[model samples]
Target: MLHTNHAKHRMPVVTAVRLAAMYEDDRMLRSIRDLAPRPEEPLSVGEVIAQTPIGTKVPVTLFPTVGINRPGTDRWPVLIQGLEEIAHWVRTQAVPRLITGTEPPEPGLPMRYEISVGHEDERQAMSAGSTTSAGERHKKALAAASARGDLAEMISMIDGSPSEPQIARWLAQLNHEEVLERMSPLRMAFDYDPEVERHNFEVLKGCRDAALRFGDSDGPHEK
Candidate 1:
């Protein structure tokens, strides 16, 4: 009787066939697998759905197949576009959902997360210009405008010798009600000169009614 090693001989062919099947399956899976989320860092499912090009550093997965359910291809543009759309939606329809007690739609839904990524080059350039030089500080004071609310007083302090016109502009930008509530009698005492006192008093009176409207609440004042 010839002792044939049938099991050993059959093993190679069987392994080859299994490998070939696996390769085919992987190829088929490639289409849908490409669509699956490929985040740079591991994120929760909700985070993965919400991420946008601006905020998150994750890539989007795209499933292009109709029904076979294969793996998707990684797509960046699609993710970006989706994020933009979601941002728009949030700005418009989602405001109510956010502010009001209305329940938001289902969680884990494929919504885009929009994030603003700052440009390092632009930031460096801005930092170069942002040094607090005397001239730069002056310019910042002017730019700060009374529009900045309570910070206007700080801007005035920084400005040192701000002109009457500049002061007026800053005061003009302030909320009328806030101006009245913050302008205390002590603030009036700062000017000992009769002429300056008269001018400041008039300005305060002019703004008093508006301040009265705010009801004298202890809140942030123009400082």
Candidate 2:
């Protein structure tokens, strides 16, 4: 069915249809989520309704269709505005990343550098720039590595050799860049495997050095 928002914005037909379907699904899911079968605990809804489907690569915290039953809380429109950017990243950043094999595989790391389909899910982190906080600083470094199209450098940042301050500095110094390049990082990543999961970001480039200084024997070393 044609939606007003769809016509107004002229979004991709498939995307618009998918978005519309969520509203319909949300209407139903929220109803079940509200049901409290136990009469004794009516105030407390025992049912848990997940906002996202299982195995989603999107952010787990925010649901575009969340609060569909409540007015002024829908975020689908927010996502709609960002669809182009998201699409661009998937096509340019994520797709190229997936197709291109990780080069110069790090010593003692996974020797299997050949990418299997569906592992290059880190759209947000790789596209991040240094503006927000320490977290963003790290992602910005990864994003810089990604822009250079160097997967090995990305691994180095996560595993060994502190990524220079120059990368983020260079991005900030740029007088002109693509709109996509300047957009704030969306904070997402691949969860297809534990080795490549977003949580691996926890141990960044400087972590090992800091650990060595602090004498934490458990810190991850070069691999």
TM-score of each: 0.18, 0.19
Looking at model 2, which ten-residue stretch has the lowest summed lDDT? Answer: 62-71
Runs in model 1 deviating more than 4 A are: 1-117, 120-128, 133-194, 213-223
Once fitted onto the true fold, the runs of candidate 2 whose alpha carbons sit more than 4 angstroms away are 1-47, 51-162, 175-223
Please list all clashing residue pairs in model 2, or write none if there are none.
none
TM-score of 1: 0.18
| lDDT scores of the candidates, listed in order | 0.38, 0.35
Looking at model 2, residue 130 earns an lDDT score of: 28
Backbone clashes in candidate 2 total 0
Tens-place lDDT per residue, model 2, 133-218, is 33344455655555443322343455444333433333333322321243222223423566545444543333334423433343
Q: Which candidate ranks first by TM-score, i.e. highest?
A: 2
Q: lDDT of model 1 at residue 78?
A: 31
Tell me how far candidate 2 lies from the true structure as C-alpha RMSD in angstroms.
Answer: 19.4
